[model samples]
Target: MLKPPYYPIIYVRGYAGTQEAVEDTVATPYMGFNLGSTKYRQTSAGKIEPYVFESPLIRLMKDHLYQDAFHDGQILPQGPVSPRSIWIFRYYDVVSKGLGNGERKEIEFHAEKLRQFILHVRSATGQDSNKDFRVYLVAHSMGGLVCRCYLQNKDIPDLEGKPPGDWKKKGVDKLFTYATPHGGIEFRKGFGWLEGLRDFLAINNADNFGKTRMREILSLEKNLPLHSLNNRFPAKRVFCLVGTNSQDYGISRKVVGPKSDGLVQIENAYVKESARAYTFRSHSGAYGIVNSESGYRNLERFLFGDIQVNVSLETLKIKMPGKEKNLSATYDIENNVSIRGLPIPVNKRTKDTFSSSFRSSDTLEEERTHLFTSFLLKTARLNKRRQSLGFSIHFRILPLYHQDKRFLPDRHYEGQAVFDDRLIIEVSKGGDSRFKVRYGWGSNNFKATKNLEFKVDKNNLSTAVIQLNQHRPVNMTAAIRFEVSAWN
Candidate 1:
């Protein structure tokens, strides 16, 4: 019997520039999927900690019993494979000088090959056409673009003008991308000249990251943006793991500059509407996002989680004191979230890292600012008997006040914040498999209390609203909303 959601996982690696690199990539068995890290940050102050993440590949096998599609020194065994199997899309092998005809193929060609690869996996896994077969596409960097191209394009003859649709019946059930430049990569230091030159010359086929080439590869119209998903796949099912550490990406970080993951800027590393989480890791290296603990946690949760939770500042009615109401001051919101018993935060966005910030005027006008989306798996609970998941969100709101285009030194404090607190949330199963949510402000309470009320809707979504009038600096009427739903 086959299990849904635990379907086969296909890993597509990033770009290999030269023919030698391609040959080297073909020589690898897992295509960097087996890489893990031993060093991690213990705190926000850059304290080093030693933690062993035995790579996503080994962890999946150890935790979820997921096996790789290889046996006895041979790739792809003859018999039927486990449903929870991992496959690598070796798209670069064809272009490798040692492996194939030594012809560099376009990303579109790789995507077309991916289509055939999926079919082969389906057949080799002994899945009949009548059976509902699905797979999860896990990609890094340019690999994500290839997956997107496969999902968004349909002009290929094999597709017959119909791209991947009906995700459950056939095709990718979900996509998890790590440090992918969905909107295309741009240089931060060069004054627009570097980007133009790269696009003009198409250096090393780097034009694949340019808008013109992206539009063709992703099958987007001239009017549509390159990052637009166009509703081809459900945006909610896509998870973008963005990296924010630019310092450790080697000499390339000098050109990419700040507010980036050493190469891809934070703003361009994700799709517009996809669920995103930011980690302070570099693009690729010892501190790379792919080999980090945060990245693996996100991938595991998104793949097998049974519950979905979204947190947002649902309403913000700020009554700025005195003259401050008329003045436009920028406000920065920081969210640091971590699951229970976890040493590192799965999602972190702080002003210091240039990942989370907004103007007070804009936040007031919008009235809603989504903080983050997280997944909770029942089987992942520390105590299986408890059947619950616990997490904490450190939410901080800082205000930068000014008047007449001049900074006000008298009103501003160095480390003071408009609001600073940690919100603790716990979700457990009550009667009839219905979820019971308990929440509390960590600074005020020792534990989560069930006294909070949740409003249930027809869509089976339960919402809990927490007012933010307890420890705020200003007279603000704001509420943080938590929306919870059952997920696969």
Candidate 2:
């Protein structure tokens, strides 16, 4: 059995509306987390076959050798089993007549209970020992908020005397949230019939159902990057899988419009400085983001994947009119990444592309800002063992140039420039996963490729920065020199 990074996984389910809703939720076996879909319309372009997803829980059990602990009627494991276990945090069980003790609890209360649950998980799985403990917290919707409250808000005690924010020291190692509204949700109200109804209802109030839907998530922004969670554990370990298909999210989508995942806005589904990826799946339904392949693939990649390649544009040199032509330039930087063997890319960046712009009139102070276009993936696959990352960047320039006084638009002024390269890295199965990175660029255009070798071990990181000119190769070229360490 594979060990180390393969710790027990605890899943926290989202919120339920009323006591009846809570009862309905607890009545299910997997608590909606184990839901699967056999029939569905084609999710891809030029495809007719329906996709079949056998739930995230099943996939985790099948792919990673994880098993549920409950054997008889006991909530905890009765006998010795695999170290790797998956448990549904039945927080709503308290509300159900058969299970949950009494009345429903508040967010803070739920967070405290979750902390206790995690402690229980730690004790049950032999993770109480400092050397062999770490849990991956996977949550959907409001569950993510519960996790955030535990990770960020509460000051729970650890193995040692619980210092302030001691929970940040260890226990929960990483987090992956699905379609969670990290930022507060906002119903579109500028120009619509629903806007009138929303205004009539005054739904944004903190006391209403709006607060229940988004109270914890709405307040997550207060815990910025400098806070205990992000600073202590680092924001890089957290990932937000954003759902973009608001069409299937039901009535909430109609009110929130197409830019949301029905219940939550897509733009608000990410934590600051955390790694995020977007999919066309909805928040939940037949087309739910949690059970979909894209969602599962991304989750598996971020959780199980070893290599993390953070792609960024280090510097840019633009060849523009030297302020004499009365012009201003803005270029949008586009990023796309694809794994060699996968049928579709991990993120929907290529299809529904997202671009960040840079203006020519911007000062040097603006250039000091660090911009990153990033994604994560599991390096190794069964059929295709050796992992390869296909990365590409496109530059779209919008030049507003004036001939006389008014800025004149030119139809022929538009141009497309791109940088494409494929990195092939072979990962070792035994001991530490050894990797070597080699980068190259061509003298000509988009076809430029490189092959410079550098070694990187498990914990050690290797970086390479290459300069691409206005088109491809003309002005700047740097010959980088680096010391090589032993690959073994």
**Number of the top-ranking candidate, with TM-score as the measure:** 1
| Alpha-carbon RMSD to native, per candidate | 2.9, 5.9
Identify the leading candidate in terms of lDDT.
Answer: 1
TM-score of each: 0.92, 0.75
Over 1-488, each residue of candidate 2 has an lDDT whose tens digit, in order, gives 32657777888887675667778888886777798776645544866786678998989889887898666767655445456888778888777777866476665677777777767776676656655467788999878877776666535344343643544455777899988766655677763555445535643222222433343432334434222244434677888887777678677776677667787776678777787776777888788888787778777777776556555444455455444454444444433345545555556532232223344436412453223223434434545544444433332323333333455653324333433343232322234544444443323343424544445545565544444443452122222222222211
Q: Residue-wise lDDT of candidate 1 within 424-444, one digit each (tens)?
A: 888876787677888877777
Tell me the spans in candidate 2 whose CA falls farther than 4 Å from its real position.
18-20, 38-47, 75-79, 127-131, 159-164, 167-170, 189-232, 317-332, 350-379, 382-435, 439-449, 453-459, 470-488
Please give the range of 10 consecutive residues that has the lowest summed lDDT in model 2.
479-488
